[model samples]
Target: MAELISLDRFVDVLQAARREHIALIGGGGKTTLLHALGSQLGGSRVLTTTTVMGHDQHGDLPVVFPTTDGDVARAARNRAVIVWRRIEGKKAKGVAREDCDRWFDLVDHVVVEADGARQRPFKAPAPYEPVVPATATLLVSVIGADALGRVIADQCHRPLRVAALAGCTPYERLSATHAASVLLHHRGALRAKPAGARLVVVINKVDDTSRRSVDELVDVLHGRDRALQVIAISRR
Candidate 1:
């Protein structure tokens, strides 16, 4: 297991250039971490975009691409690409994987949203699988403590809800009890690690009135995945 470090170390890793493709999953703190990292690395080594999955475009980072492309060979050559994990319009899905494998060298960091709220965590859409490539060194998944008791929905500003079509009974919009459920379910689903993938978990919305305490949350998260580093932050 990795030794725990100060929040500063977490921020350092988040800003470090060691990793190429980082995926922010879960809830609350995802956008916060992305924006913070994007701003710190902007104009220097980082670039950002969205797949129309959520309203992440409004965040601090500049959006380089508005759509998702599995084969971002041309775009990846000189700049990092932020991919929207989910596709919209239902007309044409995102890019293909073969193209990404062929042109994976073009990008330095391909930030992809690993999971959406519409589906369970860690599960990808049809015919689509996680593609950080061997070149990518970082793979992050985010979760929110505040999402515990609440059922994720398409609120126009939030990212895609994993439970949107998960077939689980919808709970109230956002409740303290429900927030707990969200945290447990999300953490449970994300405990497994991908091969050769370094995983990190960000527990978001710690500032929620019902979730000011971090000890239990941290314990629950660490218990789930000892190697999975967990950070608590507020997205609201």
Candidate 2:
């Protein structure tokens, strides 16, 4: 069995990881999780940005939007952040990958959302997906337990890619084994992950899944990557 963990404990892991520039990939609640981490980092100067993200998600938070170095240092100095570039139509543009590295000196921690999942609860990246910063010291790969037992074509982004990675048919119902296979694969969850970054996996929305199913997914993940950190979460 995997260790019992909670959302609060995961915050501690992120808090201790400020070598600690964090990037989020995979599916589930990436934006929700990233912003929540920025909010709960015990009042640290955390700057939240993204490689690619949608515009409506920010929801009027006091973000350092358009993220200039002087503006970011001023706004994020003693507040939780939601920094981004201008919103062109539906997308909230963010800084270039190397720029996050440049701003790392201004904040205690930097977190970026590095992929788009089209609102699906789960996904597998395409060739050009997940634009993680090379400077990130920690990577959080998330999967929604609610996706288990759902039809791949209906419930996942890049269903064909997910099918290819997990060896399941595109129209088939997803399973714990399939989720684990894709989540553990280098080209799946770790797509574009930075070298030397510590990995933490969050099986989100466990409230919608059975205990047995969630455990099965965690066990398969651990059986393959013994050192992998797997935690089950109901929400952000």
Top of the candidates by TM-score: 2
TM-score for each model: 0.55, 0.90
Q: What tens-digit string does per-residue lDDT give for candidate 1 at 1-236?
A: 12333333455655556445555555344444655554444222333322224544435333333344434444444434443334455411333333333333444444544334442322212222233334334556555544544444432113233333242434334433333333345333333334565666565545535354444656655675566566555434
Candidate 2 lDDT, tens digit per residue, 78-187? 66667777778887788777778866777777878887788788999888878888888888888877788889999999999999999989899889899988887878
In TM-score terms, candidate 1 sits at: 0.55
Task: Estimate the overall C-alpha local distance difference test score of candidate 2.
Answer: 0.77
Residue 234 miss distance in model 1 (angstroms): 3.5
Worst window of 10 by summed lDDT in candidate 1: 120-129
Off by over 4 Å in 2: 2-9, 13-15, 43-47
Best by lDDT: 2
lDDT of 2 at 15: 47
